[model samples]
Target: MHIQQLTIENFRNLATQTLNFHPQQNYISGCNGSGKTALLEALYSLGRGKSFRETQTRHIIAHQKDFYRLIAKIIDDKAEHLLGIERQTRDYRIRLDGENLSGLSALADLLPIQMLNSDHFALIDQGPEHRRRFTDYGLFYQDSRFLPAWQRYQYALKNRNAALRDNWPDEHIRPWHHQLSQTAQLIDQLRQIYLNDLEARLNYYHAELGGLETLNIRYHRGWAQDKTLEELLIQHLPRDRQLKHTRDGIHRAEWRIYAQEQDIAHYFSRGQQKTLLCALILAQNQVIQESSGKQPIILIDDITAELDPKRRELLLQFLTDSGAQLFITSIEALDTPKNRQHFFIQAGQLTPQS
Candidate 1:
């Protein structure tokens, strides 16, 4: 779905603005700190349920405002859905179709989005948690049963850890362990199947985005491949008792990105790393589009950053042809074909460039 209207109030430095958006390519141009990124953050909030730049919703409020609110009217072929989000001091609420939502996935279901920002580089440099979340979100969207299985696994894992922490007997812990192992098998199987499909699609995108080295993604199922998770759980019971937490399961899932058979961070330059990450997100979007029949709104923050002139053209050329609504921010004005619309943001105000 494409955003038909965005209404923002008391969000960062952006003026109270309600603007209609193009269904295809849109460029928000401004110098650094001109509220371009803030608007993007507001849009991201409507879809993903939070700001990309800040962990705390309170931090997103304007200096003199007591709260922040954003509403987006999104439309596909059949109907239009209204997504409203409001953040108070310590709490936030999201509403869909005028009713409160219990799960943030509800918003994602309504308006799926993929974002590329500086912090996303952590998918390569950070530990397993970031990578797992990235992988899981993709799988969650593609496979209908992935979330239920994952939720059950997490529930069982939590109870098992609690039993271990409280020094409960094996009988108590083993039941939870058995429950976890069953779900773990399903989760791991789904992840492997997801990676298989994702890897195949990533190859085409990696090449299209100018990857020169041999790019590889290796999936580690968070346990010994030779044995089932049930066997590993039993074998590691003593260790799990000592540690008081799961050391083996789908929760420990991790995947590595390699270039020419070496860690990407070591073999790929910084600029190339950014491109590789963007390529992965775009490829994942393709998979999502195929599975859901709706391409997610693509948020390209500073789309030109660290990219050379030729690479910028290639990226924009690909996006222009992708048929997905694109919201991109840039420090300098960009010269694209006439189909693209431009907006200028300055001093917390957004105005059409005409």
Candidate 2:
């Protein structure tokens, strides 16, 4: 699936715009704070049902505007449809081909786009939420059977957490805990398999990116590895009550990034971290291509943010060879002579440059 066109109104600094895009590759170039990132965020929101940059939908509207609208013309094998998402009176209306929809998962079925911004490195440096999103997105792209199971796990988790907050009796929470454990065990197993596969892919790309380092990706569950999720929750029931939250389970899991036994986040320089981020994203591209027949739309904002010339060239080459359609934002035209199509974003206006 690919987006042929995008129409935005009162979204961020963009007041009104309709821009056509290429199916294979698109380059958006502009200076800092020139709405380049906003364009990418708009595309991401259309596909993912929320802004990649912010959590609240209200923040996406222009400063003085009370509402915002985004529409994308998507092309798929069956037919072409207009996926429209609009916000009014603090509620979102999702429409496909002019028919109102109930949920955003329908949007997920139509498009699977991923964005790689500078903050994407947080998947390594920050909390489990980031790593969980990364792992779940990878799973979603690789395995079609994961979505429902994952959703059920989340539902059970929320209910359990609510029970803990409400100070419910242990017997009352026991059934939810059991159900959550069953779902979590399946998720945990699948996550381990995917991480193992991702580690291999990351190593291969890291070598190609000239890192030449042995990388180890480890998943840290909230409790001991040997303990079943149900056992962990039961053991921690008293502590969880004292803490007023769910203390141990899959929700607290984290992904540890390591380079040859050293934590990369603590030891690696900024440039090294950026390079690792690029390698991981490229590896994701490879995984999706190999595991599924679909090639995801990759949005790389500010392609040359902090890297030197050599690393930039290597990243650009890797992106070109990944066989995924890329939408890259750069300050100036890239030096690579790969017949790239460029679009210029200036003062909230976007126009094709090449």
Candidate 3:
């Protein structure tokens, strides 16, 4: 799917702006703090429920503004769709073509957008949570059912933790623990499948991205070494109650990125990590396009950061070959063919330049 156009109001530095986007490739050129990243953040919020840059909806609203709204025209092989999102002081609403889209998942089918940002390097340079979230989002893109199962697991986990905090008896939490385990088992199975697929795809794409080394992704479960999830939960009941929390479950799952049996988090250079992330994103887009018969919108923020000239062209070519619409942010003009399109963004305003 591709976004035909975007309308923004009171989002970030953008007071109000509308632009007809390129269905194939769009390059937004700007200097630092020119609202280039804000544009991508707005588009990403259409797919995801929150901004990739900020945690709260109120933070995205312009200063001195009470609310913000964004709408996009999405086009696919079947039909055109309108996705609208409005945020207020207390609540948020999403609509698709005049119909109320109560659940944020409704926005996912309207537009599948994949983003590559500087923070992505954290998957390799930081702790396990970042890598786990990256893997989970990738799995979410593939399997729709995983979301509800994940939601159920999170809800049960929260309740169990609250119960522990209240000094509830161990036996009183057994039922909730069992319920959490059931959904967590399903999540674990799906995550394993996705990790296997992701590992294979990453291997091939890593080499293609000029990283000749083999890349490995390991999913570590809290009870992986213990007995079945059922047995582990039963065994850990007392320990968890003493600790006053849900100690063992999918919430504790981790993902480790490695190269040649060595931890990449401590070993890989920043440039290598960025290249690996690029390959990972490109591979994910390719897989989605090949399987779903529809390509997702690709967003690459701060494209010139730590990327060599050769790798940049190669990455751009891969995006072009994917046949997916791309929104890339850069500081300078790219020496592409005359037919290529670009927009210059300055002081929160966007205008077509090439």
lDDT of each: 0.84, 0.81, 0.82
Give per-model CA RMSD: 1.7, 2.0, 1.6
Best by TM-score: 3
Displacement of the residue 163 alpha carbon in candidate 3, Å: 1.2
Query: Best-fitting candidate, measured by lDDT?
Result: 1
Superior candidate under TM-score, 2 versus 3: 3
Expressed as tens digits, the lDDT of each residue in 118-207 for candidate 2 is 888788688789988888888887777678878887898788778888999989887887887887887777888889999998988888
* TM-score of each model, in listed order: 0.94, 0.93, 0.95
Candidate 3 global Cα RMSD: 1.6
lDDT string, candidate 3, 1-354, tens digits: 688889999999974987888778888888888899999999999888678878887888999999899988888888998888999878998888899988877676567778988878777777767767777776666787788899998888888888888888767777786778789888888888888888898888888889978888877876766567767777877787789886677888888878989887777777788788888888778766664566888898877774788888888888888788888888886654556669888899998985
Q: Give lDDT tens digits, candidate 1, residues 1-354.
A: 699899999998889989888899899999999998898888888878887779876678999788999988999878998888889988888888889998888888778788888889888898989889888889878999988898899898889889889989987777876778888888888998988888777778778888877677899888998988888888898999899888998889899888768999777888888778867887888888888887788888887785677777776677667778889888998885586678999988888777
